[model samples]
Target: KSPQCTPDQHLQTQSETQGLESAQVTKPVEETLSSLSALLISATANPENVLIDALDRKVAFLVNFLLMKYRMKELVRKADIWKMIIQDDEDHFHEIFLRACEHMEMIFGLDVKEVDPTRHCYGISIKLGLTYDGMMHPPEGLPKTGLLILILAEIFMNDNCVSEEEVWKVLSKTKIYSGQMHFIYGHPKELVTKYLVMEKYLEYRQVADSDPARYEFLWGPRAHAEVRKMEILEFLARVHGTEPQSYPSQYEDALRDEE
Candidate 1:
């Protein structure tokens, strides 16, 4: 003899039964998580293993390749996978990743296009260009960092050597007045000491006989490696309205030497 049950009461009973069955089904999966974690710990315990190390390095390489080939936003759809795979601090990952890119660029001439400018996807470094006349030019509409560095470099192009104090004096005399007495902050001498010297845009050498603070700066490896003599000569020709063939004797010699 069963009591009559309303439709609502029957539905509630059914729901409760379904919940119990679902929990029972999930119980094994929940229990296995701890075991899975322990197994993972055991697998990764010997980080020095050749295979494990190889796999770790390969994973890092692949991650960099993907980031370079595809826009970051497109690749980040699987952020969870990245989080687990990277397993390092974001800054560390980026530092290694950049070094990997720079290495590839140096060895294989491979450039990474990680961003779609119109799509608002990724951040990229803007390259500063030096015109033939040795003008430090950024792309249009960007803040100007001045041509003091480039001008200094150009003046010393032939011998490619100068003292820091001499450069500072020249820079101090040179003025850029776009507005009412807007001065360039930070002495050029200090800028050379702090950044250019370390970046290898300019090579600095000091001898025991020389002044302690006085270091001679010359064009660094990067200057020769990146800036072609032909390009500079071409720019000069354009600026001066002369044929590339009839350039200055020094520039002509440079071109021939480079060739």
Candidate 2:
């Protein structure tokens, strides 16, 4: 989830140098990407134990971005006006997402592709789960990782699996700016850093589309309410399991209640 800046007023010029856009934006993503060359050279073991330090230098830029955007936020005097413009759900989030993609392409090794908002939901849902909250339109109220952590939970809660395709499709939607060579909102380097941070919980699982009906139904503004009801009941019923046998009985009982 995106962290709220300390405040536009609190940010200082010294702090701006610490943010994400300083170097990685100017250099190649691989140049900024972590490598095991040093670790490999130092190792005596037959097989080098090279740990991939994804962010070796990523945070320097991300922090700066937050600060840059924070200062920009301060330039606007109207509090409500700022809220409408910068909230995660607003189009501004998309702008950030687009800028972020600029850095993501190089760091994460993504190829350009078209994103189907429905299919892309998996990855977007994961990131946004951490950013915007269903309960709180502005999750700035939550802990630093609160929105981020909950997003990891909500996204992986269903199945602990992420597909590269899912990630690629979503990243495809971001706009790449030529000038900064990073996200207009933040750094691309954070793609690897944030992914590394969230990876432990986001183990990918295969989502099956065995049924034609299941494939046909996904996200929609007017999704079938009855189907949604069944999904809620079924998901809840599945969670009620203590043992395999009793779960069948619980499922039946739950279905009856839903009916």
TM-score per prediction, in order, is 0.36, 0.21
- 10 residues in a row with least lDDT, candidate 1: 133-142
lDDT values of the candidates? 0.39, 0.29
107-223: candidate 1 lDDT, tens digit per residue: 122333445545433332312243221112222222122232333334333233444444443333333122223222233444455455555555666622554444555666655
Residue pairs clashing in model 1 are none
Error of 1 at 53 (Å): 66
lDDT of 2 at 32: 24
User: What 10-residue stretch in candidate 2 is worst by lDDT?
Assistant: 214-223
lDDT tens string, model 2, 147-223? 12222222222122223332332223333221223322233224222432343322322235432321111111111
Off by over 4 Å in 2: 1-160, 176-181, 184-190, 193-259
- For this target, which candidate reaches the highest TM-score against the unseen true structure? 1
